[model samples]
Target: MRLMPRSLFGRLLAVATLATLAALLLASVAIGHVLERFVMRGFDDRLDAQTMVLARAVDARGRFDTTRAIDLPGFDEAGSGWIWQVRSADGQVWRNGAEALPVPASRADAPPPPPPGMASERARDRDRSHPGEGRDRTGQRQHFRTLTLMRVGGPVAITASGPRRVVEAPLREAMLPLLGSLALLGIGLAAATLVQLRIGLRPLRTLQAALGNVIAGRQHHVPTDLPVELAPLAHELNTLIDQNAEGLAHARRHVANLAHGLKTPLAGLGLELADRDPDGRLAAMLADIDRRVSHHLRRARAAMPGAPGRGAIPLAPAIGDLVDVLRRVHADRPIAVDVAVDGVTVGVDAQDLDEMLGNLLDNAWRYAATAIGIAAVVDAGKAVITIDDDGPGLDANQRAEALVPGRRLDEAGPGHGFGLPITQELAELNGGGLVLGSSPTLGGLRATLTLPL
Candidate 1:
């Protein structure tokens, strides 16, 4: 239902095509009119010559001379659709062929003559039928283009006429080539418009590609070395990017400073509580407060904009290092760690990727009974990393609640319950996601991490 295109390129092309078609149509009309007039003028010239020849047969006394008249082809032939007439001042009429040529009643009533030595006054009779004289073989009224001349020395008028087809046929023949040439010119113009659009819009396409690189963290800013029209836009975009980066860095520094300042006081309180309380309840509350503060600060930092020009980090090395560390951390348990990762890479910072994977691996290490499986694959431009533990896994509701900060299913575990939440936040901040499910291979928990590749 839409009549116009939405994209800039599409809209430009559409406008160009419509404009080209309109111009071609106007040219066709204007050129056709000019060609028609040219043909008609040539036809009238022939009629003028015939009228002058027939006028020569009349003398100064306004008397017709039949023997002196020349017999032109299609002029004296009957039903030829070409005819001539001469009217004398004495009201005598003379004509060629059996057709009665229509003439004005008097010399004064006739069309005015042309300039001296030029063609005569011309008129077109389009619809009048002269009985059997001017009718075609099918009895249809024949049309004619007539030229009338008034001799200078006599009150005599000579008129010459030919069928309308005499002018139309040649015009039609000339138009075939004209129309064909115009059609070819139209096609050429259309192709040129398309080429012009593509060349003119190349800068826009380049700007789009540059913007994409900036968004993908491959470039720090849009390049300003563009066409004059787009250069200012690119400069403004780079300025905006720099401003945002500075603001994010300032906010992150403020959050980190505040968290560090809180940590010192929390540590002092922990020492004070350790001496005053034996049950350790106060110390535990202080520790929980410190953990919450640390969690929020970490989450805030993760949620901030990532640095530009961060290339893709290889998945295999990151996963391998995390798995090795986990194996050592859980050395007491006879856990078997199996890693099946590919050469796929993820568009996440190396430190962020390590943090997210380390958290997931540590959680799996704590809960895994005998074996842990870590695997990764590339799917739909994303790297999917799944960590499975062969331990008791949470049900549907527990799995959902486990993602919430400080929500631990088992109190026996030695965790502040911030690991899964931190991992999920980091994953999302890196344009990826983390989902918990029942492990199909290990029959326990499955932590699937999806990151851009």
Candidate 2:
């Protein structure tokens, strides 16, 4: 049920064409009316002049003078289709051209109204066809232009008339070129409309192409040399792209610093554990070695860049896989991981999503007493994934402290307290963030991760 076109160009072209055609149609009607009036005015003027000629020939004695009245060349012909008539209270007389046509009976009595008013009345003419042609002797009907007047001494009706073809033929001839000119004008208007539309919309089209280039990774920023109307938009887009790039570069540098800072400790641990010592101090050192390595590895994973074409990870399967692994890991605890994720997909790299979800689920398994719940949905063009656990959740103060990079609230717990910070960093890298709150349903901590769609 779409009546109008969808594209801007199509809609604009259609509207412009319709408007132009409508204007042309209206103008044609007005011009045709004016032309008809002009042709008729000229015809009536000629008839009036001839009528005055016939009137002037009559003297003060009211005598019809054939010698003087017949001086006009058309009057001398027998069937030229031009004819005249005169009428008064004393008498009425008329003359025909070479056609030898009779005067219309109504003309003498009433003069058939004034000139042009009687123009539609058909006059008779001889048929040019042979007897075998099956044509009428009176020939085709033709209209005339008749004029009537009254003299001082007597009522004089003088009509100089001709066939309709004589009047219309000239009008038709003139119209051929007029119509041709109007057609050219219409075509010119159409071309101008298209050119105006293209020039007016060129900046918007260029902006669209530039955006496509950025999305396709062909360009890092939109071009800035645009019209004043579009310049701000391009500048803002470039600024956004530069900001994202800077943030990504900063994250990469932080990860590199983490790796470099931990290198010496890792090397020393490797040497101590290489002796294969069986003492309690050696076991504690081994535990510390595992914690440090796992924390730094999670940080590095979280810092990885989210590039284009690095496929989005479906929230349901990713959370489900992590939940299944954690369930097995904590079999003795009897933790119930309930997943309620539908068709939500997060715009994050698959490996990054896995590392973030793995750390979060593992943290929940260590803390949760029995039941854990996971759910996801799409809202406002973003993916919202929430995980809830039924356990002794941390307070506001503890929650804030736990998000710090290396803050451990529960040192006795089987984690290095890097899960929330790593997950937060990973979410941000994917144009999203993480939130910690109280779960109303599970009466425990609720971890909400919001990522771009």
In model 1, which regions exceed 4 Å deviation?
89-91, 102-155, 281-285, 288-376, 385-425, 431-449
lDDT of 1 by residue, 1-453 (tens): 998898877898788888878887898889889987897677666666666677678765667898888767677687777777777756788878667764433454345434454333222221111211144444544333333334444356666766767767887888889889988988898788788888999898998999888876679898888889999999999999999879878877888779878988998888878779888888888878897678657645665667344567988888888777766777788788888887888877676787899899988888899999989998977889999998999899999999999998889979888889989988876778999999999899999999998
The C-alpha local distance difference test score for the whole of candidate 2 amounts to 0.71
Candidate 2 positional error at 379, Å? 31
lDDT of each structure? Answer: 0.76, 0.71
User: Which 10 consecutive residues of model 1 have the lowest summed lDDT?
Assistant: 124-133
* Reference-based TM-score, model 1: 0.65
Q: Stretches of candidate 2 above 4 Å error?
A: 30-34, 61-63, 71-79, 97-150, 217-220, 232-350, 353-453
TM-score of each: 0.65, 0.48
Error of 1 at 169 (Å): 2.2
